[model samples]
Target: MRNLASLLLLFLVLLAAGPLQAAPRRDFANQYQPRRTVEVDTRREGDSLRVYLRFPNRIAQRRRVPLRVMGWIDFDARRPLWQDTVRGAARRLRPDGDVDRLSFALPISRLVSGHALSVAFGDAEDAMGGDAAWLRLTPENLNRSFIFIDSLSRPLMRRYVRAREVFGVDAYAPGQTLNAYRYPLSSLAAAPPMATSNTLGQQPRTLGLQDSARFNADQLLRLPAGLYLLRLGNRGPSQGLLVEENRFPQLTSADELIAPLIYVSTSEERQKLFDAPDPKKAVDYFWLGVASDDQDKARQLIRQFYGRVVVANTIFSAHKAGWLTDRGMLYQILGAPETVYRSGNEERWVYRGYQSLNTIFVFRAKPSIFAPDNYELVRRPEHEFLWYAAVELWRKGLIAQPGR
Candidate 1:
């Protein structure tokens, strides 16, 4: 069971790096369908880390499986120091996929900046499809002054100017009747939106959960997805709060389909595609050229190669498309590493590459207000040499080459 937990942790780590739709797709709706996943939100409240697990109500709404999470806090030494668990019995939730949250504050007195915290949901021993994620404790994460949205809640995110950055919504409007404050903070008990505005684009309405009964900006739960500000005592925008859905992964697209070439393309080769009249065809030509003159071989290569792109899309997606990420690039170019080392706050992938040479890549787990699972690649000069050699093999229709 311990071995299984370790493997489960490793799988979740890699899965977190990419998008969650790693399975073979038969329809486009599957991509947009609510994902069966979990998101971790942390804030510093006094001496403990306020941890919130956010998910869609539909996740386990129909199943009898109990939802549970096991977690711990780690200090700067990069090791676990304490562990705790929270479980919720199966229950009904309204409006399928309407957001819901399970929150528990854990002790973090020993946790300073650079420490980490993690949580795993569901039973690992029973082969249940549990999910896990971790966060690196930092002031930016703990210090964000946010209004709690319970009785009206989900993942607690900050109010910002743009929804694109943090997986939330944008401003419904800019100018308002109320004056904006400068660095102001406020709280909400239960309130509704003010009267409708004369604004053309953003009409005033009661924005509830999923915008069902949206009230005013003061109401945390019924807040509409758009641009607004942190108002003081129900005044104007002091600081902008862009709100939108933060936890869901983005669906794949055509542009993302070709983004993986960053790792394989040389500076000159990549420019050719950009300079071409049709960049899409240019991408196809490059792959066909790499396949040497065989259409069948090119088809196989594209299928097998981009298939990895799909998986990478499902696995590495965070702030950007998965293929654009460092881990995604490596996975696309090198396949899965032979071994992966993971802790509460770090990851190391060891790949046995060509000639059985071990090419080791180290990634540091960097938690952000928007993404807790984001990891940064620690680049080394040796990586360039390794990357180019692998590209050369692919250029000759060898790497990730499908069998006849």
Candidate 2:
């Protein structure tokens, strides 16, 4: 940790060189989509924020394509507290067909509570593609005890570990007993068409008992597909460290493929899918119908719809599969919002050019024992018309690529 923190001095050298050009602050929808060029993750360790950048095989294979990375502490969406650029070539590049990663740490000793670490990716040629991602952090969460993947030194920002993977719970209060409670993986029900309440209430879900363990420095154990709660003691306010175990966000299981169809399919169509003998065939046939029996169009609809499903799993998976969440429902149907603005504990997603009066959707951050970063959508009756229209586009196989 000390060595990583020391690397922050490199930012000073960048400052002495000259004032680097700044990219435009434009669309931020790409931040929520599946990154095609690279994947990024961050974790706060003591006074340092460790950042990891993973480049896909395709990006790594293009040796001539120069890639640049820049980062800053975003206290608000409008301005930056501190900013610096890092050279991608400074790190060794991997060959094609292999995943390559570049990692560095930034000191956060001066930061106190609320701030987002924003990182932007671009190249020397165009440089105006202001695509960036952010990691929201607080001092308390960093210092407190948390869980992380045993194989990796960072926190589980990906929100999942492969089935049967071993992970460890780092206890802040040593020698005290920490109990682990496991909750079965439950799929979210269909999002209602109208707003019923201001805030969605969370009910106590079924929890299965797991082996009790002492609060050692780190307790490492293997787990199946479920949500695990690590609390300091046996009784509390139901608040604790929640860890979800699953495979990558890709939809592989039959149930996984069938559940998200609720947004695009009618009740009868969904019933047929659920009762079908072969799930894969049923899914293919449903998409075929949506494409009006056109094989090529059917393939496109499948890719686009399921691609958003994969991205939803990447972005919104928390206490449940992201596809089943309220935000996931709109994301899959409407594609990425035209604009996303984040304020204190709430995010407003704006989509322009719609025929309805409602263009912005507000999601309030509702943290729970199972989902620490969970955000619930504020549903409304006015959303019914827009929701059906968007769903109609998907059914007709006319939806464009997200963030287009």
Candidate 3:
């Protein structure tokens, strides 16, 4: 009986060792069968090409997969082909090397009147284990190409060319009777004309109101270059309108110009202004109606805010205006900091002990240094407003210091 019991225990040990010995071999096979997937999309500003490679959640005990991307451009055709290589343990294993996203910009000069754009992708050495998809460019598919308009003088044109059957086309000589596309305002349920009295008295004034009126393409084509505010109506649900100055140079063959105007709503506009890098003017505009009651106070506040912005500029001008820069804007709203630290590319701010508030601000200086100076702020997370809330609580004496 004792001998039988010992043999049984030995058998269990052998069973466990068998699978352990085979695990490494399976891992080796997976590493070699790397799988990949990719997608390509183009917007007016530029093209976004994404490649996603999936691998086993665990690779040699590490959570990350290594991927390398290589690409080439067909200058005349304005096309690009990108490829990827899966290396290291990932190459030896058949993890889910499925998807990777890689983005590249095509120069606007490369796009010509008759030329078509195309993109392709595959694994290193043209490996057959992954999937590849290409986006073809044609006059009817203008949206698939990136058309950048960096100047206010440039005409605002649609980035995409729909199916040729969807719209008609006409061509013209440059600087000679520029061709125009017409879109019926009634067809666009989103961009309704505005009727509000709110107008920015500035030279390039901004108008914001609500109204429901049909706008003709001629009106859109004739609008001078500058920001124009439009409101669809004040009665029912209001539709927002944003009319910028310019024409889209790439979609010249198009005769119909209609876009969804999804991002240009009034609320979106206000949110954009609030998140703007230098939002003082926007804030002033928000309170414009009340400025008449206490002009002195309003002026004082504006000066104080501007002063903060100047100080922020002096201290935070790594790449942009002090008030427009991340750290400068945070400092402006949060007032002064209780503690601050600088480390390589990051600036950290700490504000402690105010009611239920504790906060930290981190700014990346190097990246901002390379960004455009006139860039606007578009988003501010909830945590960023904590300092303002803390100040309010501190003033209300809801929070007490540890020592006191």
Candidate 4:
């Protein structure tokens, strides 16, 4: 009787411990899988506008996965806003789900003066989860503010101009009515058509102009050189007008206008920039930012940086490739470690500077078809640049070191 009781107690304890171990392992697996980041670019066509969302190859998998997209357009006060879903490509999840690429497109009619468009992605269903990421589309006459939504209804994640160094634009009409349009000349398929008025309102009739009277450059150029909304009237239905100035232009050159305003807003770019080179660029680009019009220069930068990442991978890669993993490449660029530790599948990289600003890069190794060893950087501390800046500041005697 005594032996039986002891055996039963041991079995129960083992059963309890089993889940404790398994739970963390499962959670770690999910947390480690790389989350996809999206990039959006818009251009105008004849009567329609084409919006393209580019996904990095690192985010796509081998199993069929659906991406849900949603969009909303607000034209004017008189007409109701337009809202609908825009489905994205059905991507396949790779065995590891760590490195895949995919993209989607949405098309709509020409945007009039006062219209604003918003778009986002839906949550993933299965083992993966999806969070809404959005882009707000504004006409050329309005301030070139790109609103990036990390969470809908929540405060904006980033609101700024596009990176002009990477994108270029040509403005036709200089000062008259600010007909300045900015597009990433390198990435755009072709020039988009220009529209005169806002056409997204629920009641298209609100714009008293004849349906056939499309807005021409002459009409658009005539408006006072300021930000204007292409809606109905400024007042009530009785006072139906064609155009109304709402926002002002931020700058003279549309490219200069939108550059700093729009940002990548994700650490993925930095991570990929580290791993993306065929043979990473030298440390030169890291110390020297990328040039605007030089692809060869960018490629050279990648090669240089990637070379060091390869070294880090050779020295640090445990179950995964060093350049492919977070800590490996980060440590390579960041130089010798101040401290290093691991929690489950995640390896944290700590760099101590003037202040205790620690940058954490969380990584996970997952099964994938591309390679036997796959790893991803899942999380990074916010405002990491400040830490690097702090380091520089300390070196320059601009700031005191921590615990000094």
Give one digit per residue, the lDDT tens place, for model 4 in 1-404. 99999999999998987755321111121111123334444434334454544343444333344455433242112222444544545532222233333333345443444344433333422212212233334443122212122212111111121222111121122222212321111111101111112421232222222222223222312322211223212221110011111221112232321221112113453454445443134223432344333556545544444444444433333322333244443433444444434333444444565255655444565422212234455543453564355435422323222221
Higher-scoring candidate on lDDT, 1 or 2: 2
What residue runs in model 3 are displaced by over 4 Å at the alpha carbon? 1-292, 354-356, 364-404
Give the number of the best model, judged by lDDT: 2
Q: How well does each candidate superpose onto the true structure, as a TM-score? A: 0.52, 0.71, 0.25, 0.26
Q: Summarize candidate 3's per-residue lDDT along 343-365 as a digit string, tens digits.
A: 33344555666345665555443
Better of 3 and 4 by TM-score: 4
* C-alpha RMSD for every candidate: 16.0, 11.0, 20.1, 19.9
Error of 1 at 15 (Å): 41
Q: What's each prediction's clash count?
A: 36, 2, 54, 49
| TM-score-better candidate, 1 vs 3 | 1
- The positional error of residue 50 in candidate 2, measured at the CA in angstroms, is 3.5
Residue-level lDDT tens digits of model 2 in 357-395: 448888888876566667888888888788777777887
The clash tally of candidate 1 reads 36
Instruction: Estimate, for each residue in 1-404, the C-alpha lDDT of model 1 and write its tens digit.
Output: 99999999999998988866643311111111225345555655556666666555545454456544333344222334544444443432233256545566656655566565555444542221123444556655565323333333444432332223423222224232222222211111111011122322352233222222222333323333443434323532233333333322332333443445655666687777777787778777888898887888888888778877666556555444455566776767777665555544667676664444666677787644333456777766566666666677777887642111
Sort all candidates by TM-score, best to worst.
2, 1, 4, 3
The true-versus-predicted C-alpha distance at residue 193 of model 2, in Å, is: 5.1
